[model samples]
Structure formats: C-alpha cells, structure tokens
Target: MSKQHVHGSHPDIVKRLKRAEGHLQRVIAMFAEGRPCLDLAQQLHAVEKAISEAKKTLIHDHVDNCLDDAATGGPGKSARNVLAEFKAISRYL
Candidate 1:
C-alpha cells in the first residue's frame, strides 16, 4: 500500500508532537536520575497515548478534507484511491 498524502501543516499537530518530545526528554531525565521503574513506565505510557491521539487527529482531518471531497464525486478514481488509503490507515489503529 501507498502512504496517505496529508494535506497541510496543522498547528495542533505540531504542538502535539512537541508535547511528545517533551515527554521523551522527561523520560530520559528520569532514567538518568535513576527514578522508580513504575514512574518511568507511566511516563512512557503517557507518551504513547499522546502520540496515538495526535495521529488520530491527523487522520480525522485528512478524512474530513481530502477523503470527503473524493467521495462526493470529485474524481472517481482518486476517490477510490483515497478510500483505500484511509482503510489501510484504519487497520493500523
């Protein structure tokens, strides 16, 4: 399968990624400080959840703008292609 073409840069998406990055830095600092394993695990889980939510937001936006346009008879072939891509993405989640 091919990669889905994301439309434009989303500020919210960037913010989410930055938050995830901060979480990662925290995880590293915790490790360096020899923090409790449970605390580290919880932070890791939070990072994972944040990343997952960010991905969902992107997918939702793509569907709303690109996929919806295609489905509405904008271009038959392109619509089918985009629909397939969306389905593949759903599988990943």
Candidate 2:
C-alpha cells in the first residue's frame, strides 16, 4: 500500500544511515590509501554500529507505529498478516 506520510523516526533514521554511508566511504578510501590496520578497524566498527543502530530504530518504529496500529484496528493488515510481518521484520533486529 501507498504510504500516507513519513512514519515515526524515519527522518532521523535516514540521517543515521547517511552518516553510516559516509563512514563506509571513508573506510573504503582508507583501504586504498594504505591506512593503518587499527585505524581501519576502528572506522569499520563505527560504520557497523551506525548501521546497526539505524536498523534497530527503523524496526522499533515499525513495531511501535505499524504493529500497534494493526492491533488497534487502524486500517492495517489482518492479525495473522501483522504477526507474519512483525516476525519478518524482527529478523533484522
């Protein structure tokens, strides 16, 4: 279905992902520049953490808004479908 508007925390999540993307790009450049292994590892870790936190925020927002809507009869999917969707999304977390 078409989205009606920006969901909760999505704008923040997008900003986080963009930051992570920038970090990842820097990490790639570091590799090419023969940066020290310790520096590379630290940068890579930051990138990984950023992506992980973004994923967590997205999933939590989905559960808080979408699943809550479905449970409250807010023009969402059926109960079975909602549960399935929740399960599907939870795998990423």
Model 2: per-residue Cα lDDT over 32-82, one tens digit each: 999999999999999999999998998898999989899779784898989
TM-scores of all candidate predictions against the true structure: 0.81, 0.87
- Candidate with top TM-score is 2
Report lDDT per candidate: 0.85, 0.91
Checking candidate 2 for backbone clashes, the offending pairs are none
Q: For model 1, what is the alpha-carbon lDDT of residue 16?
A: 94
lDDT of model 1 at position 77: 49
Residues 1-93, model 1: lDDT tens digits: 998665675788889999999999989999999999999999999999999998888878877887788777766547669779789877756
Please estimate how well model 1 matches the true structure, expressed as its whole-model Cα lDDT.
0.85
Every model: Cα RMSD to truth: 3.4, 1.7
